[model samples]
Target: MLESLYIENFAIINQIQIDFHSGMTVLTGETGAGKSIIIDAIGQLLGQRTQPNFVKENRDYAYIEGVFTSNEKINTLLDEMHIPSDTQLIVSKKITKDGKSSIKINYRSTTQMLLKTVMSNLVDIHSQFETHQLFKQSYHLQVLDDYCGKKLSILKEKYFNNFNQYKKLEKEYKQLKNEELSDEQYDFYLSQKNEIDELHLDDFDEEEFIKERNELNNFEKNAKHISQYKNIMDSSKGMMSLFKDGLNELASIDSSKIQDLHDQLYDAYYSIEGINDDIYDYLQLSNFSEERYNEVQDTYFKLNKLKRKYGASIENILDFRAELDKKIQYFENRESVISTLESKLKTNQENAFKIALDISKLRQENALILENEVKEILKDLYLPQVDFKFQFEKTNLTENGMDSVCIVVSTNVGQVAKPLQKIASGGELSRIMLAIKTACQHNENNTIIFDEADTGVSGKVAESIGKIMKEISKNQQVICITHLAQVACFANHHLQISKQLKSNDTNVKITILSDEDSIIELAKMISGKEITEQSIAHAKQLKKNNV
Candidate 1:
C-alpha cells in the first residue's frame, strides 16, 4: 500500500507531502483543483511517461516520490532485483525540462521498465478510461483467468510449455518432409563432406602453424645474428680466450691475494664458455628448408579457402561440418528420418491436446462461478436485472489453451444476451467494471486507486459503489477521488484538495479533514459553495447511515 507521497515542482503543485493510511480514503474538491494532477503525479511514480510541461512553468525539473510498506511478494521481487529488502520501499522519479527522467527504487538507480514492473505488484490505479477495457474481447479472457487464480495459472503454464514443444516438432517434421534432395545435390553434399574429412582438423593448431611459418621466413637473418655473437665470444682473441689468459697469469702469482683473484677469474671464464656451447647447440638444431616453408604456405592457403567458403573461424567451420554430416545422412536415409520425426510430432501433439482439454474443462467450470459472483455484485451496484454469462468457443491450440471466452450480457429483462460492448450503457459499464473488480479481488496487499471511476452515476448507485470500495478496503487499501457527497461520506479518511494562490502562482493544497471538517466538505459538495443548515444535516445523516 502507498504509505505517503511527495510532489515538488510538478505542474501546479510546488511542494506538498501527503501521508496516506489503510482503508477507504476519498479526495474531493471542485473541478481543476489539481485532483487529476495528483493522480498523474502518482502515475509518474508508477513509471508513466513524463512530459516537459509537467514541470512547473519556470522550474528546471519535477520530482515525485512514493513510499510503500513492503509485503512478502514485494520483498521477493526486491531479492530478485538484488535490492536490499526493507520494511518500507521508497520509489522516486525526477523529470527534467528537457524530457529526460530518472527513476530510483530505495534510492538505488533503476530503469523505468523495472520500476513499472515492481510498482504493478504494489499498486493498481484505475481511471475512467480503464473501465472501458471491459469492452475488449481480449481483456475478457484475462479477467476470467485472473478470477480462476492459481489452479488455472498452473494448468495454463503446463499447456503453454507442451504446446510450444509440439509446435517445434511439427515445424521440424514439415521441413524434413519438404526437403527432397536431387541426385546432383546429393553428390555435391558428398563432395563437400569428403573435402572436410580430408583436412583432419581435429588435431590442427592454426596459431602454432602461423608462428612456425614466421620463424622460417626470418631464419636467415636470425642465423646471421647468432653467427656474429658466437664469433665475438669464442674466437682465440675473443673475450672468452682473453679471460682464460688473465686467469692463468693470476695463478702464476705466489701471493695469497693473487690466488684469490685467479679463482674468481676462473669461475667467470667457465660461465662464458657454457654460453658458447649453448649457441653451438642452437646452430645444430635451427635448420630451415625451403620445402617445409612451401608446404606450410600451401596448408595456410587451403585453410583460408575453407574459412572463406564455410565459416569465419576453425570452430565455426567444425560446426558447419557437423551440420553437413546431418544433411548427408538425411539424404541417404530420407524415408527413415521422416518416419521418426512424424512419430515424435504425433506423440507431442497428442500430449499437448490432452493438457489443452484439461485447461478448457477448468475454465468452463470457473466461468460459471465467475458469472454468478459478477451477477451478485451487480445486484448490489443497483443493476439487479442485468444478466451476465460467459460465451465459450473451442479454438485451435494456443498458448492460452484452446479457449476463446467472451462476456455476454443483457442489461434489461427479456433482452436477448449480446456482446457487452454493444448493449451496455455508460452507467451500466461503470457498475459492471466495479462488480468485476470486486469479484476478482485477490489475496495480495496491493493498493487500489479509483480516479473518478464512480462518475456517470449518483444517489444510491454512487453510495453502493462507495460501500463496495469500503468492503474491499477490509482486505487492502483503496483510495478514490469523487465529487458526490453520497460516495465521499463513506471514507474512513477524507482529504480535501483546493487551489491556493501563493506569490501569484496557483498551487495545490491538501488538507486532511477532521470529522467536522469532513462533514463541512460533504455539505459544500451537496450545496454548491454554500453549506446550508439542511445540507449539513443531510451530510451528517449520510455519514451516520454509512457507519
Candidate 2:
C-alpha cells in the first residue's frame, strides 16, 4: 500500500505532501484546482514521462517522492537489483529544467527500468484515458494471461523460446535456397575455374619478362649505337689512337716534362680499350628473334587479360579461386543439406503447434470462468440483461500464441452478442471496465488509483461502484478522484483540493475534512454552487444510509 506522496516545486502546487491510508481514499475538488496534477505527480513516480511544464513557473526542478509498504514480490525485485530496503520502500524522482531526471529507491540510486520493475508491483493507476485499451484486441491476451496467472506464463515462455528457434532456422533455410545456383550457372562457373587452374602462372615472374621484352624490342637501335662507340675508341682511327701517337712524340723531346702527361694518356687509352671490348662482346651475343618476341607478347597479353577479369594481383586471383571452390562444393552437395533442413523445419513446426494447442486449451477453460464472473459483476453494476461472451478464434502463430480472444457483449436479452467495441455505449464501457477490474482482482496490495472511474454512472449504480471500490480496498488501497457525492461519501479518508491566489501565484491546497465538513462538501457536489439546507440534509442521510 502507498503510505505517502511528497511533491515539491511541481506545477502550480508548490510543496504539497499528502498521506494515504490502507482503504478507500477520495480526492474531491472544484474544476482546475490541480487535482489531476497530483495524479500526474504520482504517474511520474510510477515511471511515466513528465513534461517540462510540470515544473513550477520559477523553479528549476520538480521533485516527487512516495513511500510504499514493500511486499514480497517488490522486495524480491529490490534484492535482485542490489537495492537496500527496509519494511518501507521510498521511491523518488527528480526532474531538472533541462528535462534530465533521476530516480532513487531507499536512498540508493536506481535506473528507470529498475524503478518500473519494483513499483509496478506496488501501484496500478487506472486513469480515464486507459479505458480505450478495452477497444484494442491485442490487449485481451494480456488480460487473459493475468487471469490465468503463473501456470500460463511458464508455458508461454517455453512456447516463445521454441518459436524463436523455428523462425531463425526457417530464415536460414530460405537464404541457402536463394543462394543455390542453377545447372547452367554452375557449368559456367566450373569452366572459368578450370581455365584459371590450367594456366600454371603462379611461378612465372611477369616483372622479369617485362624487362627482357623491353630490351629485345630496342635491340637494333642498341646495336647501332655500340658500333659507333667502337669506331670512336678503336686503336687504328679512334680518339685513343691519336692520344697515344701524340704521347710518344712528346716523350722523345723532354722525357721529364712529358712523363706525367704520357702516364695520364696511357691510363685513358686502357680505359677506352676495355669499354670497346665489352661493347663488341655485347653486339656478338645479342639475341633479337621474332619467334621469341611473339611468344613473350602473347603471354603478356594473356596475363593482362587475367588481371582485368580476376583481380589486379596474384593474391587476389588466388582468393577468388578459393571462393569458386566453395561455391562448387555447395552445388555438388546441396540436395542432402536441403533435405535435412526440411526435416528439421517439419519437426519444429509440430512442436510449436502442439504447445499452442495446449495454451489454447487452457485459455478456453479460463474463458468460461471469466465470462460467468463478468456477467455476475455487471448485473450488480446495473446491467441486468447484459450478455457477456468470451469469443475465441484461431489465428496464425504469433508471439502471443495461436488464438485471438475478444469480449463480445449485448446490452439486452435475446440479442445476439457482438463485439464490445461495436455495441457498448460509453457508460457501458465504463461499467464493463469496472466489472473486469472487480473480476480479475489483479490489484492485491496494489495502490489502485481510479481517476473518475464513476463517470457515466449515477444513483444506485454510482453507489454500487463506490461500494465495490470500498470492498476492493479491504485487500488493496484505492485512491479515487471523483465528483460524485455517492462515491466521495464512502471515502475512508476525504481530502478536498481548493485553489487560492497567494502572493500572486496560484496555490493548490489539500485539506483532510472532518465528518461535518464532508457533509458540506457532499452538499456542494450535489447542488453544484447552490448548497441548500435540504441538500445538506440529503448529503447527511446519504452518508448515514450508506453506512
Candidate 3:
C-alpha cells in the first residue's frame, strides 16, 4: 500500500507531503484547487513522464517520491536490483528543465520502466475512466484467465510447449521436401570427392614427381650425350676395354704410389660396371606410353579441381565431405520424425480446444452471476429503472477461450439495454464503473483511486456511491477526490485541499481532517457558501449511518 507521497515544484503543490494509511482516504476541495495535482504527483512516482512545465519558476527540477510497504514479489525484485528495502521502499523521480527524467528505488538509482513494472503489482488505482475494463471483451478474458489461476497457468505452459514442438517439426518437414541440389552441382561434388578417394596415391611430392618424370622422358638423349663425351677421353672403339688396358698399364708400375693408383683404377672400373647396369635398366624403364602420360595428367587436374572446390588443401576437402554426409543423414532422419510429430500435434490441438471450451462454459455461467451483481449495485445508485446486463457472445478461440463481453445499459425500463457505450449517461458511466470496481476490488491486489467519482451525483445516488467506496475500503485503500459532502462523510480518513495567498502568490495545501473538521467540511460542501445547523446535523447523521 502507498505509505506517503512527497511532491516538490509539481503544479500548485510547491512542496507537499501527504501521509496515507490503509482504508478510504478522501481529498476534497473547490474545483481547480489542486486535488489532481496531488494525484498527478503520485502518478509521476508511478513512472509517468513529465516536462519542465511542471517545474517552478525559480526551480530547475521537479521531484516526486512515494513510500510503499514491501511485498514478497517486490522484495525479491529489489534484492535483484541490489536496492535496500529496510522494510519501506522509497521510489523517487526527478525531472530536470531539459525534460530529462531519472528514477530511484530505495535510494538506489533505477529506470522508469522498471519502476512502473514493479509498482503495478503494488497498486491498482481505478480512476472512473478505467473501471470499465471488464466490460471490454479482451479484459474479460484476461480476468477469467487470472481468476482460473494455476489451472490456466498450467494450460498456457502446455500450449506453448506444444506450439514450439509443432513449429520445429513443421519447419524441418518443409526443408526436407524442398531440399535444393541441382543435378549439375551434385555431379560436380560427386566427381570431386570420387577423384581424391581413388588416388590410392600415398605421400608423393608434386614438384619432385614432375621433375622425375621429365628426366626419365629425356633419358635416351642424356645417355647419347654422356657416351659421346666419354669418346673424347678414350678415342677408341671398345671404350670399356681401352679404359681397362690403361688401368693395367698403370698397375705394372711397382712403386707404392703406383700401387695406390692401380687400386684406385680398379675401384673406378667397378663403379663404371654398376653405372652401366643402371643405365641399361633406365633405358628399358624410360619407355613411356601416351595413355600413361595422359592418365597422370588427367589425375593431377582432377586432384587440383577437388582442392579448389572444397578448399586449398586435400585434408580440408576430406573434412568437408564428411560434414556434408552427416547433414544429409540428419535431414533424412528428420523427415520421418516430423511425420510422427505431426500426428501427435494434431491430437494435442484437439485436446487443447476441448480444455479451452470447458473454461469458456464455466465463464458463461459466471457471467450471469456477475450481471446480477452489477444490477443490484446500480439499483442502489438510484438507477432502479435502469437496465444493465452482462452480455456474452461467442468469439474466436483464444488462449483464454471464446467469450465476447458486452456491458449493456438502458436509462429506463422497456427502453432496451443497448451496449454500454451507446446508452450510458456520463453520470451512469461513473456509477456503473463504481459498481464494477466494488464487485472486483476485493479480488485484485491494487489500490483504487477515484478522481471525482461522485461528480454530478446527488441525493441518494451520491450516498450509494459513497457507501460503495466505503465497502471497497474495507478490503482495499481507496483515495477519492470529491466535492460531494455525502462522499466525504464516508471516508475512513478525510483530507481537505485549501488555497491561501502568501508572499504575493497563490498556494494550495492539503490537510487531513479531524472528525469535527470532516463534519464541518461536509456541511460546507452541502450548503456551498453557507454552513447551516441543519446541514451539520445531516452531515453528522450521514457519517454516523456510514459508520
In model 2, the clashing pairs are none
Most TM-score-accurate candidate: 1
**Candidate 1: clashing pairs of residues:** none
Could you estimate the TM-score for every candidate?
A: 0.80, 0.71, 0.67
All candidates in order of lDDT, best leading = 1, 2, 3
Best by lDDT: 1
Clashes of 2: 0
Candidate 2's C-alpha runs over 4 A off are 181-333
Ranking by TM-score: 1, 2, 3
* Residue 5 local lDDT, model 1: 98
What is the C-alpha lDDT profile of model 2 across 1-547, one tens digit per residue?
8899999989998888899998889999898998889999998888888688888888999999999988787888888889886889999999898788989999899888887878777888776687889889877777777888889989999999988988887986787688959999899889878867766666767688889888876886788787787778664978778877887887786666578877887787788778778879986776777689788777777777777989997677777787677568768988876788789988887899899999999998998898899899888898989988778999998888899998889998888899888999988998888888878776577888999888888999999898888888888899999989998888888999999898899888999998899999999999989999999999998889764
lDDT of each: 0.89, 0.85, 0.74
